[model samples]
Target: MTFEAELRKGNFQVAECTNCKKTVWPPSDFCNQCFKEIHWRKCANEGKIIEFSKQNNYYFCLVEFENTIKVIGKISSGIPNKDQHVRIKRCGMTDDNYFFEFSLI
Candidate 1:
């Protein structure tokens, strides 16, 4: 399945190179390194918070998944801390931009 298509349906997906077996970030049709075809698969539901900040009452964090994909998402509830594990609460396209919400695990 295509990354954007699955993402729009609230299913997170990652692309891996068929030849190099390397994960591709930014969801491409081909691997950036070896230029091989990519295969799409479901990404890990859980990720680690790399960094976080509060804007007003909402917390936003940079989360890393499978040690490759990094996405910025908002904390759905509770306070967030660095290195905390989080799971995807919601994800979809909003307007032309991607939006993600996470809950602390």
Candidate 2:
């Protein structure tokens, strides 16, 4: 299965560069830094919202995880503040489509 499938199944994971020892976000086939092979690994769900914006009733956030990986997740049903520490409330397929949602903590 693809990374999106795994993550949608509530599997918190990311790619790590074996050579550089750096974590990669938006999982790729090769390392962004060294152009080497990358492997999947588990990642902490905790992150800080560095920036955010609301559109169409959803707060979109640029969450920085482990200070290296930044991902966009939607926040629903709560007032989310900037720089707020958040966690993955849950991940799954919405209407059989991949979806990500977070909860402010």
Candidate 3:
């Protein structure tokens, strides 16, 4: 399934190439390594905040997971700092697209 579909189901996934065994984040239709068809795989849902910024009402964070999966999400509860560990609280899609919101650990 697509990333949006995974988020809609309250789960997270990444694309992996069956041929090359390469993992792809930000889910893509094809693999970059071997140009093979990609399949979605469940993610660990654990990451560390690489960078973050506070906006008007939200804290936007760039969370880096294992295998170099970097997802940009908003902090669910409160502010988070760089290198802070976080976990997925919930994920959903708005009218626009799938959004990942996390909580600091």
Candidate 4:
């Protein structure tokens, strides 16, 4: 399925930066780099895993969303980089929710 299709099924909103022209997830009002009032735009849900690590009780991946915005999230049950495309990563304190994250493949 495409990113737009996922948006239709889900209720999450897309985010971007007005000053720096960057896209962000989890909807931030301030740009991480410029610290300006950010804008909101529909994301492509396409990105790359720039960095990843396992720290005790958590698996973290620093995903560069849309080749512009980088965000970190927990990894799901799968071999790392097996899928280059956008895949779901488990989130939340109890590890129930799954959000999009890309791999190098």
Where model 2 places Cα greater than 4 Å from the true spot, the runs are 93-98
The TM-score ranking, best first, is 1, 3, 2, 4
Stretches of candidate 4 off by over 4 Å are: 1-12, 17-39, 89-105
Candidate 1 per-residue C-alpha lDDT over 1-105 given as tens digits, one digit per residue, 9 for 90 to 100: 388788899989899999999999988999999999999888999999999999989999999998889999999999999999999999998876788999999
- Give me the overall lDDT of model 3: 0.85
Maximum-lDDT candidate: 1
Candidate 2, 1-105: lDDT as tens digits: 456767777887788888997776667867888988888887788999999999988898888889887777898568788889989877666676656688888
Which candidate gets the maximum TM-score versus the true structure? 1
The models' CA-based lDDT, in order, is 0.93, 0.80, 0.85, 0.53
Structure candidate 3, residue pairs in collision: none
Q: How many steric clashes does model 3 contain? A: 0
lDDT: the better of candidates 3 and 4: 3
Better of 2 and 4 by TM-score: 2
For candidate 2, list the clashing residue pairs, or say none: none
TM-score of each model, in listed order: 0.96, 0.79, 0.87, 0.47
lDDT of 2: 0.80
Residue 37 local lDDT, model 3: 93
Q: Candidate 3 residues 83-103, lDDT tens each?
A: 999998887787757778899
Candidate 4, 41-95: lDDT as tens digits: 5554555666677778555777665665555666655444522444433222223
